[model samples]
Target chain A: MTGIFFDAVTLSFGKRKIFDNVTLKFDCRKIFGVTGANGSGKSTLLKLAGKILHPDSGTVNFPDNAQIAALSPEMKIYDALTAVENLKFFARLRGKILSDEKIFELGRRTGLDMKTFGNERTENFSTGMRQRLKFAILLAVDADIWLLDEPTANLDDTGRENFFAEIQAAKSEKIILLATNDVAEAQICDEIIRLPM
Target chain B: MKLFGSRCDCVLAIVRKDFLLNLRRRATFAAMMMFALTTVASLSLSTGGAILDEKFLAAILWVVIFFAATAGLSGTFDDEAQAGTLSTLKLYGDAQAILFGKMFVSMLSLLALTIFILPIFCVLFDVNVEKIFLLLATILFGLIGLAAAGTLTAALTTSAKIKGGLFAILLFPVTLPIFLPAIRLTEISFTSAQVDSSLLVVIGAFDTILILASSILYDYL
Candidate 1:
């Protein structure tokens, strides 16, 4: 299934044109990377794809079952909630009730421990640990499209490797749109497209 | 979906989160409570000399609610705005959920603030409880309108912290038409004549319109 189809999409911030009539089609089940220098439309394009930004011209269509799961800083993965509770909260938003098996599977894939990171308020965790729990949240959602902004941001080398492993695991059957400033992140994706300013 | 399972359930959960967050943070809660308390107390002492009447006292009491609600409602989205969680919420599918949830929680707490101030208002103003129910009713109606308006304005002002404090500055003028009628209706409740049923009707109308406006502009905000 095809996920997002953007044709001749033009985006502008006030008088400045960020994306110029760009055409792209995203397959529903592949890992795609977006690479660009500073001031390029990398994040803007992802926002456009996620329906968070409207194109000045042209259209971006979603697949029949397209749903977006982005990393959020406020995921409640703390002393108040078990891993089941955390995943349950996010999954319930989309009417999907993830079982305990699925929660642990995603936790392990993202290198987050339900037994450790769970049952503790996310307030106590380090930034890197909280980010991992967010990754666990993204994986827990059975959405058709995944748009990740700065997925490897502020992570150590080990955290970066764990994130890559999680992406590899997630890439099997979902359209993955990875938006990052780091060009090295491009190597893991099947193909990379650089949006011109 | 069942009532507990629907997005409506999330509304109270979000309200609970805001209340809990306020409860846990002692300094902020203490300060806001003190602010609410002293305002009501001073008003009571000042008006305790005036005719010592319930009707006039009820009038003074609601003025306190207006300011308190404006102050407290602005804090609804403060955490998300400062932390850049607003962007994350925009990407999240349930903008409606987030909007209504925050409004529900913020407005509910503002109501709680009203609850806290009511007794003080009753005591200091020496208000007659029976006649002042209209004052109480108007406070609820007024907060809903204020919260809806403040929530939308807060969403627009999220990028700038300075404007958040000036919420009432924006809210009062736009909502000016509401105050006179609501206050007049409240004053009538003190009178023995036929009640102006339309005062609350107008507030209800205003509430519906504001809620609709907030929900519609939420995506763009």
Candidate 2:
């Protein structure tokens, strides 16, 4: 009951049904993997969990006060700002004002180099570096639920390993709904929901 | 040191972000200012040393403002859409904060134009106002209406296929009532004619109604 439940949820675009009479329960204190092919409503499922999109019919039930932090490749980064500035901006959006040391610590934990984290504008960052920055932001927030869509898409092996470590540490403390098609990523979850089943 | 500590603080944070972003981009603001200057210059050259009526010149000022605002203000939400930031902001802040933040930016942009371009307009057109205070008041009130209406319409049309065209089509008709009285009041200020207190009251009332309506309906956007 402390987790999210989607009861008889229906979503459609024009005549194409994305989710039809789908019932899903995403529990806290565990990582739930949603795996499918590219067009399998994986991101939509996460968006529904984050309350960014409403189901056409049926109910999405989460605790009224639950704080949901969502990370996706489509999520925005202020490219004009430095990595530290981007973290500060996102922290303020989450209503938390972090000290410089704490921010640097988070960057370090997420595998970001201290020098690049402090000095580089994200516009010049490589794809793997940007993914690390996004993970750093996700790690900084204290939320009840974390919804991640294709979080490892742009990362190299080292970055993926760092991500898995951070996410594994937080699995018991937060509800993590991961949308991915990677077999290795899905294997780490306690349960996997393969869409279009 | 921080601007997003409370709900009101969030509004200011959004405004500050938008102001800085626009300053960095500069294309939209520069395009609008250039258009305004070109319009004013063309009008001046065509008039050819003739003394245009004060009412006509005042009307010209509003016309330039109308076009410039329509040109630049429609893109307020376009940046949010492009950067995929709107969904994040919606999750983070209340609707009123987002709405007022955008409205504040629109108002500031228009007011900046009034401040920078109006003086040049007066000099170029060889017109001087007898009541500068009243003229300023009228311009401010009129811009409030434009900002309120412009923010709403921009939000509504952001996802439309023909974005700028749709924005103008939806915004211009709704803003004319404000423009008509604003032009009249400005003319009165320029000619030092009897101040029609009733007209000022009407413009103020329209502005209030626009802001209230936009605020109430913003959640839907």
Candidate 3:
């Protein structure tokens, strides 16, 4: 799909121009970090790339019928599901049955434990834990593009490390686009693009 | 190589996911079941005498279906909208398939609920429900139309703060055209056991139009 390319992509909501003729490209299978001020459009850029919202102008080159794995800020993990249950739900969406062995492997990769919390419903898991679980689903799905928005928003130091590790392992061949407010998060990125809020 | 669209596999996947959600989430299914049962019981008990009048009986049946439709839609989209799965869904399949898929399950549930409670309705009202085949057909056609119309309106206004209320309001006017014949055909067949070919034609025509329009407008919705 041209390795995640944007040609003069511009998005304007009302009088404010969220993005203006912003043209950029990233090679496929690279970890890219997108950083911006409070309203500079880091998240908007991700949504545009994810095809959730169209740019007001210009075309975004993307794989046709790409199987996407996204961790949006607005994502709400089923409070009633354990980390395993949540992963299985997304896995099935891609037409893959969730095997027990596969789910265990995902939990391990994302630093989630099923022994104590796997059997339990996710309703009790902390917000940071929910964040970790969502990223875990992204890893399990193994989609062509990974659009992560603030994946480490609520995570503690260890969770942050695990989040990056999961993204790195998952990006061996998949395109990874991360939008974050954390500068440390950008350090691991192959390319960093700063957007205005 | 069908990348997207309402193929059997895609629809089945959505239906399977929905049915699984219904089974896993006790509160949602329990709430729908209890509401269906209670509404049926109260109508049967409170209106037994009044329903002896054919017009009143027909009206009550429509009301029951209406409320049942509402109860079903409320829980059906809850998973996608409330679960924040809407964004993920956008990337997986054609929006039309997802729309029809959700509508199919809701309509299926409506059919099951209608059948489950119809016997009790027949006994409670003590009306000779004439033209049994036609009556069943009407429910099938009527609910499919309802599901299509409701599916479009629900997606259009799902972002609203009062989605259920907004959905009812948005649908009420759009579907007014169907009400007269739905009632007329039901009343005609039930009262006289005379099958009105014209009435079924009207309902069938309405069904086709509504389903087609809803399907076409879903991309916009």
Winning model by DockQ: 2
- Write the residue-wise lDDT of candidate 3 on B175-209 in tens digits: 66666677766776577756667776777788789
Name the candidate, 2 or 3, with the larger DockQ value: 2
Chain A TM-score compared with the true chain A, each model in order? 0.86, 0.95, 0.92
The parts of candidate 1 lying over 4 Å away from their true place are: A72-88, A97-102, A156-158, A181-184, A195-197, B1-5, B9-13, B26-32, B46-48, B52-55, B132-136, B159-165, B188-194
DockQ of each: 0.32, 0.51, 0.37
**What tens-digit string does per-residue lDDT give for candidate 3 at A94-139?**
6666788887777776677766677777888988777778877777
Q: Can you write out model 2's per-residue Cα lDDT over B165-218, one digit (the tens) per residue?
A: 888889989898999999999999899699997888898999999999999887
| 1 or 3, greater by TM-score | 3
Grade the docking of candidate 3.
acceptable
Rank by TM-score (best first):
2, 3, 1
Top TM-score: which candidate number? 2
* lDDT of the candidates, in the order given: 0.70, 0.84, 0.74
- The residue-level lDDT of candidate 2 at A183 comes to 81
lDDT of 1 at A57: 94
Off by over 4 Å in 3: A156-158, B1-7, B24-51, B78-80, B91-94, B161-164
How close to the true structure is residue B202 of candidate 2, measured as C-alpha lDDT?
91
Better model by DockQ: candidate 1 vs candidate 3: 3
lDDT of 1 by residue, B162-197 (tens): 774577777777565566667776666656656777
Q: Give the CA lDDT, 0 to 100, for residue B56 in model 3.
A: 69
